[model samples]
Target: MGDDGPAARPNILVIMFDQLTPGALGCYGNRVTHAPTIDRLAREGVVFDAAYSNSPLCTPARYCMMTGRLPSATRGYDNAAYLPSTIPTMAHYARAGGYRTVLDGKMHFVGPDQLHGFEERRTTDIYPADFGWTPDWLRPDERIDWWFHNMDSVTRAGVAEVTNQLLFDDEVGHQGVRALHDLARDDDPRPWLLVVSFTHPHDPYVTRGRYWDLYEGADIPLPEISAADVPLDPHTARLRRVSAMDEVRINPDDVRNARRAYYGNISYLDEWTARLTATLGALGVADDTVVMLLADHGDMLGERGLWYKMNFFEGSARVPLIVHAPKRFSPKRVAAPVSLVDVLPTVTDLVGAAAPAPVDPLAGRSLIDLCAGDPTVEREVVGEYMGEGAIAPIVMIRRGDLKYVHSPVDPDQLYDLAVDPHERVNLAADSAWSAQVKAFREQVDRDWDMDALHTDVLADQARRRLVDSALRTGRVTPWEYTPPADGSGQYMRNHLDLNEVERTARFPR
Candidate 1:
């Protein structure tokens, strides 16, 4: 961090939660665990009621949020698709606009170029960084057993003092607190952007006693449609087989316990958010920082018998987003549909980055436009699925009150969300809604070239599989991010003056 008069530039804090659905949060109308901190955030910030992931899988969703590009545009089709280093990210924009960017948790980047554009990233990502999770689109019936999620993660969910995810998130919180302390130093003059990503509430749904107790005796709701009554469409049936959902039976108690733990995990993250905001206030950086709260994607969490994300359904594709900056932006709820890809231009607009070239096809628009009490023009939000459960491209378009899902091989699903909130009925074949379906289908045709997309997906899959096999042969090195250490220059050193180091490290002058 260098330069001068940086206090005029606002600091940006992005709080990213993993796989926590908006419908489970207290602010979003859940009666499960009481999440006062996050609820308070919604009270003071602009909460987006319709925020969706461009692609629901971890790697592709995160890439969408980072670069403000759709998965189709970037060829980010699956979890193992490597993010090309050539693309400029939100971090790159921030750097161009003179900000110190840092990442503290799971970004799920699956390539050799791990950092993307962030100057420092504290914790290693939870998933593999190579092409290990690549899906074989060639073999639709063959399930990739090792990485494909099963019902075990759902049935085995319960309380835990310390699970693998708990340990990782705890360290993420620790590093985040430390990063705050580091940011508060007067010696560092550049405005900083700290992205504290937590891998929680994602899977193996477990929580500590403190959070678990918060949901005790509370009414934890079950999925809208149980597995017994699960309406299996052609695409959903494919998802069930790939996930091995038919192998296990989830009793009422198991569903209750799992939902209870998932709610508890949301509360657990609330405590973390409360502590971080308190830290910002303690460091006297609250007024100069604009905080954003969101998730990469949402979990189905047994919703409609779907356990994980990869579908266009509301439970899996929609995420919670709250932007809080009372000093600069007013508080108001926005019902307009937006995407994670919007985050890039929103951030770049806030920080005044070097603008993208005129020909750049970016899907993101500045959220600042919404802050000025302007009317929200009706717009369409598009999402796609080229991941594990599909042999062909699955595309989704949400416009106004209708949601249309198109799978190349399967029959399309059309739902008027205003009338059917649960997405129980598909109007694609209904004679009454034939005109609406026809209109959406026409737009789908205009938006995508299905034949070309299918070819591209298979080509990328074959290329990645070959590369993965070759890399596994001999002297194989993981592409996992190993953070560079700052040892001698920090704390104490035999050759340097300790007092000078202490003074420079001290915060608040």
Candidate 2:
């Protein structure tokens, strides 16, 4: 940690969207997506060409990004896995360093510990807050179609005036803008850290009528790996079962409509990001704010015949990361590989705050130099998947132009991304690449004890299921996280609500 001065520290705003793959953006070389706002930010900011989520699922990925620790070490094995409240997150460190930290949207916390260290959390989570989503390793082939992912989201995708995800995101945006207004007006001297997370572009592959019309009759991008050419890897075949892909028959029309709606949803998210950034300018704090944007994980978007995130394919793991702080860092593209786990350290670096003293030491470093267009040497991006689609601990290592995926039960995969960008060829078992595969396997063994970790994960799942069953005796099933005094404490931004603000402020007079 380095301290410049109290006043020198800038306010940090993190805009995180769900399931956004970087390649789909206009700045990332896609010519069809209508996301001009994000493209503008990429032009003005430091764009990481190879940024990934260390954990390629929703809950585990957020936990890893929050704590700068690996999923296994944090006990964040699955979506329903509870992150112990004692784990000191970045918000806690920021607060200790004299920053007002706030969260305004989804984090997908499964247990009762909602606010890890945020001073304020607005807009309760769109997903559940209990162990209802916990997966059982004993039943590997059983498809939990009731809640687990399915093709229905893709098969029945289209336009709508409003949706479950749209309303939640609208509220998230409303509260986020209001929170910014309040922070601007408040007399607090500390710097601020506001994370505005959104749940859009995630599911049901739908958007509003306005955004849906943006891509009317547009030629949607189909799967890169065609149906006939899709080589079935072991892990991918498992995902097919977990997602129930075989249960439904999806035609080319379904693919076109789903891709159209997904692209439309990205445009809507771009509009949301624009609104937040425009508000920063409107409040006259644009110059003193440092804005960063990334996603927890990425959507396959029908790439390689995959829909959503589960494996460590570039489509599912790689995400967009852009950091814009014109006063502190230069604007350029960094081609080195980075991870979401670096965010905590990056924020601490930007604000001159010391890293949090955690139960386990951090494995991430700050991206300050990378933002200055200087990248580290020998950058290797590492990620793990203990969520769904696997019974064993799945690990992946990406260094240079090569990506290595390893698991005990599945066949090892090695791909030279520079030569074969689509990962169509696996050089794992080839004798010519035996040295690379051997080195990567040795690293995996040193990094994790797969057999012990597997048993521990099973035990942890059993304990959680027992607790869930006992709690369901008299308590509500599928507990939702609704914060106290929801929406009643929001600040007034419009003239229609001015009297309400005044009335609430002048109470007991």
Candidate 3:
């Protein structure tokens, strides 16, 4: 550990993945995937077994985590939802607390203000920053084929040495390594926070031959509950059409191949995780840094006829959370449910940083106490989805062993995870659980005005659509981020003294 004084703040490295589910990780009990680095981290860190994404979509989930608020509070309704520049993020708080904040990869920021609060952003986002992906609840049945997920990702899954996603993640990994080396050499006095996020194991499920060959003879199991096994719910039925599942015919071979590729990509990310952690160790910052691993949300991966995330099913919403700070926290597994919204506050607490008084009440409390095994902390997780899969707001509350999902249009669902871990039975309809159902419904009524939220979502969608149309009409300036580079600052520059330049460039000074 560093000095106990207030001036000695530890660096924080947050390694995040896209659409990574706990079910696929070996630490979380999947025997097939090869993630030794992650497994080792699990052994040394505090693991939250029931961690979930507050929102299942990309933009809203990232926004909620960054702001320590829920989707509705930020008005981050969907993929194209705009986050106003005025909102304070985790980076803002870290910077305010005298830490150097940096982001090395994808954050899915969906507006012109790309650098939310980071002092430096090392890579451009993988997804677009425009409002072109805004969902219209008015036309709930239509699928935006151009951008919406489809069966093609599964039907065409295979091994590839280089893919768009792979290339992006390669750069993400390289930049993160380079940033750590640079930070080690720099004379900056402040502790640093670097978010090394990757866009992989997400979809189109392709991986390098090296990674794919790792699972050559391994047994890849199919989904426990297949589409043919159970009837689809209303939201999943809508997701099926949204993702164009009905238009394509997927055989068992396609499913197996896709699963194999997904597992391989996970191995590929494991390799990156090794690289980042190794760099931290080589830089001699391993002990003085706190490492966190999590994901924005989980991929359904052909669970119950679903592929991508949209609903609050355990497969889609459950994320893997590991906080590795052995010197500061003892290793333990926390079965209590936690959510992505808790990230900002937790990071603040981990670094001993003081966040500015929040503009609004934070939806999350610090998990540091819980990481240290404090039992008095509440064990509840709240989630809301105003994304493409539904016409109305869907809210979820996970308390103790029960998970209750509610929406105005569809029938409510209640699952007792203690006894029925697979969520096979819906206790909401059982006469014996009527009181429990009513309590959840009343809690929903007390917390969310579903009707008002629906109206607000529709209005926001209309406004964004109008703005998108106007922007596309003429000489369009894209909101897509392009990283800046200064050519004159390259090696052996004409303006610098040769000896000093070489001395400064070399490490181990």
Evaluated with lDDT, which candidate comes out highest?
3
Model 1 lDDT tens row, 1-509:
12452234688999999997899987888866678999998998888898899899888999999988888888899899888998888898887788899999999888899988899999898889999899997788887678888888878888889999999999888889889998787476888889999998898878888888987788778788765564679888888999998889878788888888888888888889999999999998887888999998898888788888889889899999999887766788887888898898888877763534424578877777775547755556889889998989999989898899997799989998899977888888999999999898899899899999999999999999999999999999999988788787778898888788788787766
Candidate 2: 10-residue stretch with minimal lDDT = 1-10
Candidate 3 overall lDDT versus native: 0.90
**Clashing residue pair totals per candidate (backbone < 3 A):** 0, 0, 0
My TM-score estimates for the predictions, one after another, are 0.96, 0.93, 0.97
Which sections of candidate 1 miss by over 4 Å? Answer: 1-8, 227-230, 353-359
Mind giving the per-residue lDDT tens digits that candidate 2 earns over 1-509? Answer: 13452246789999999988888888888888899889999888999998999989999999988988888888898888899988888898888878999999999977777888899888799988888778888888878767899998899999888889999999999999988877876767677999999987898898788888998777777787864575798899999889988788888889888888888889988988999999988877777899999999998878777889988999899999999876677679888889988998888886683434455687677888788766445577888888878888899898989999988999999999999988888999899999999999999989899999899889988998898888888956555667667355466665457866766444122
CA lDDT of every candidate: 0.86, 0.86, 0.90
- True lDDT of residue 355, candidate 1: 36
> Please, what are the lDDT tens digits per residue for candidate 3 over residues 1-509?
44662224689999999999899999999999999999999999999999999999989999989999998999998999999999899999889877899999999998899998999999999999999999999999888889988898999989888899999999999999999987877778788999999998899888899988999989988888888776567988899988999898887788888999999999989999999999888877888888999999999888787797988989999999999988778899998899998999987786573656566789988889989999777778999999997999999999999999999999999999999877778899999999999999999999988999989999999999999999999899998788889989867888988998777676666
Regions of candidate 2 where Cα sits further than 4 Å from its true position: 1-7, 354-359, 477-479, 486-509
Give candidate 1's error at residue 339 in angstroms: 0.7
| Ten contiguous residues with the weakest lDDT in model 1 | 1-10
Q: Rank the candidates by lDDT, best first.
A: 3, 1, 2
